[model samples]
Target: MSWLVTGGAGYIGAHVVRAFQAKGIDTVVVDDLSSGRRSFLTDDERFVQGSILDGRLLEDAFEKFHVQGVVHLAGFKYAGVSVKRPLHTYQQNVAGTSMLLAAMEAKGVDRIVFSSSAAVYGTPDVDLVTETTPKHPESPYGESKLIGEWLLADQARATGLRHTSLRYFNVVGSGTPEVFDPSPHNLFPLVFEALLDGRTPRINGDDYPTPDGTCVRDYIHVADLAEAHVVAAQRLDAGEPIEPVYNLGSGDGVSVGEIMRAVAEVTGIAFDPEIAPRREGDPARIVASGELAARDLDWRMRHSLTEMVASAWEARRSAPVDNV
Candidate 1:
């Protein structure tokens, strides 16, 4: 069965692509290279360079590949950036998803594993965010992802398309030497980059109600997250039904300061993080419940925060630096 991985050249998408390929499954990719890198795609997979919103391009790609299932990972994801450019976020995420669904319908593709975000839960009142939690996304990026889930669910009910919307939180770690996030926006990569450059990594807040007074988040390993996509695909292949939402997280929240210390320990760098003002629209704590995903798809994370930080540091160090 040929699988179509949209945005397959990005960090998490590349890892998902590799996971599918490692299982000796045939897969194809369509990535615009806006933030995604061509370096992430393997030699064996068919690669199409384009945006998901481009209907003509998607039509041709879908028809050519005869895609059976899709792992939809395309869209903007930066929480802060979304606040700055809400319209751009809505246009790309919502419109891009609508275009993909339309193309899927046209191509007779019936199954999809949509990449949703834990940001959809916003600043939940509860410490433990489950699949049943009420969604109150704080940023446009989160709102857009939630809307994507709605589109998938609505389309599925109308068209009988099997779909799973996996709500993930703080996807960290590296998959292979070839697949890595260079100049990443996430905290771990920023900390790793700061250590490598001999600079202080910036922490957002230092006075939260967490154990050490810093904001805590669920940091699930990227490889583990990537593995979940494969598992979701298998479940779809088996003709099993699933609830529309599955929260993919480690069920453990780690603080930003703790992450800095871990990076320093892993990279052997004595780095002090500069504490900055907390960014707006950030929740103090959001540890998601992956019980639904584990029970239904048999998926669970399998890496420690230390392992995640170390692997990311290795990938960042090995990749070439840009100095023009």
Candidate 2:
């Protein structure tokens, strides 16, 4: 039986596929190619081009690929844009997840590993967020993800479905040079784009209480995050009990100013980032404890701040100029 990774052609999803392949696991992909790039996929991997919303299509993929487990990563991921397109977000995230679960039930594919977001916690009130943090999502995207988790819980209660959800923020860098984050809303890509376009990157706020007077946020390497996902799936397949949720985070966190310095140093560019006023609802510091993940999922900050910037910069530079 093979593992089916939904949205496997996407940046992070592609890395997950590679991770599974590295462990000698047979895997298949089901992606709609909405935001996912076909160039990121490999020729050896079996591919199913379709949306997760089509339960019949999912069932077909499951049966054809002999899918025993799923890593559900297909969804509308933009948080800010979700506000403008709330209905679209709900349909893609909520309805799509429901359909995936239904198909899993019909096909008897019980194991699932969901890709959730830290947005489900909104702007957390505490300094360090854990699994037990209050869930008061600030955007429709976050709410939809929370609902996705609840759907898994309800399904597990109804049937004996085994599952886990990984919530995280600012996933950056590359596990393989073939895959690079192409998100416009993401900080790493935004900064990399600015430098490549001969423009200065800007920091929104520099007067916060952080060590460098900038807001602190977690920035985990994509490779580290993907490893945890594979391990979680393996444990579930072995019938080992796992935590319902885990936070892939950097306990100390990195600031925007520090990231700017790293970008300049790594890219051989020397210019301070332009600083602007802090955006409303922006928290000064919001990092999470990754202790639980480290204990159970083999999680750790394997890459440093400069390493993160360097790897991301290398991948971005390696891509074609027109690919932008």
Candidate 3:
């Protein structure tokens, strides 16, 4: 039996698929190529071109691959744009999750590892966020993810579904040159794109309360995050005890100023960032403690900030001009 990874053709999803392959576990990718790239998946890997909103397609893939579990990563994942398009976000994240769960139940796939986000805790009031941090999602995307977690919990209570949701903030770096983040909204790609185009990258704000005067947020390597998903799946396979959620976070966060400096150092492009007005709802600091994940999933920051910057830059530089 194989694990079906929704959105496996996307950046983080592709890394998760590779991690499963490295552990000798078969994986089947189901993606609609909406924001994901088809070339990210290898020719040898099993792939079903479709969307999770299509329940019939999910059911068919589950049966065709003999899927034993699912890694649910397919969803509308832009917290900022979600405010302007709330309905679309709910449809893709909330309704889509409901459909996928129904398909899993029909196919007897009793295990799942959900891709959650730190957006669930909008502008957390504490210095370090934990699993118990009160959820006050500020955007539609955040609300949809929180609803997705609730859907998983509700389903688990009704059925014997074994599941866990992994929450994280900025997921950066590339495990392979074949896969690089193509997000137009992410900070790394934004800086890389600006540098490649010879435009000085801009920072949203520089007057925040952070030591560096810019906002601070957690960043984790994509490969490390991918490995944690595999371990969570293995635990479910072994019928081991697992929590309903885990935060794959860096206890301490790095400032936006620090990231800009890292980019300059890594790319040999020395230029100060242009400081713009702070975006609405921007938080000065938001970091989480991954101590729980450390004990349960062997989660740790295996890569440094320099490694994250260098690897992402190398991969982004290697991508085709049109893709960049």
For this target, which candidate reaches the highest lDDT against the unseen true structure? Answer: 3
In model 1, the clashing pairs are none
Off by over 4 Å in 3: none
Scored by lDDT, model 3 comes in at: 0.95
| Residue range 1-324, candidate 1, lDDT tens digits | 589999898989999999998887788999998888887777766999999989889888888887899999989888888899999999989999999999999989899999999888888899799988899998999999999999998998899999988998888889787766664577777776676677888988888888988888899888888888898898898887777889987777788888888987888888677989987766688798788888986777788889988888777777766610
Report the poorest 10 consecutive residues by lDDT, candidate 1: 315-324
User: What C-alpha lDDT do the candidate models reach, one value each?
Assistant: 0.86, 0.92, 0.95
Local error of candidate 2 at residue 199 (angstroms): 0.9
Candidate 2: 10-residue stretch with minimal lDDT: 315-324
lDDT of 3 at 238: 96
Tens digit per residue, CA lDDT, model 2, 173-199: 987677788999999999888887888
Global lDDT of model 2: 0.92
Model 3: lowest-lDDT 10 consecutive positions: 315-324
Give the distance in Å from residue 11's predicted Cα in candidate 3 to where it truly belongs.
0.6
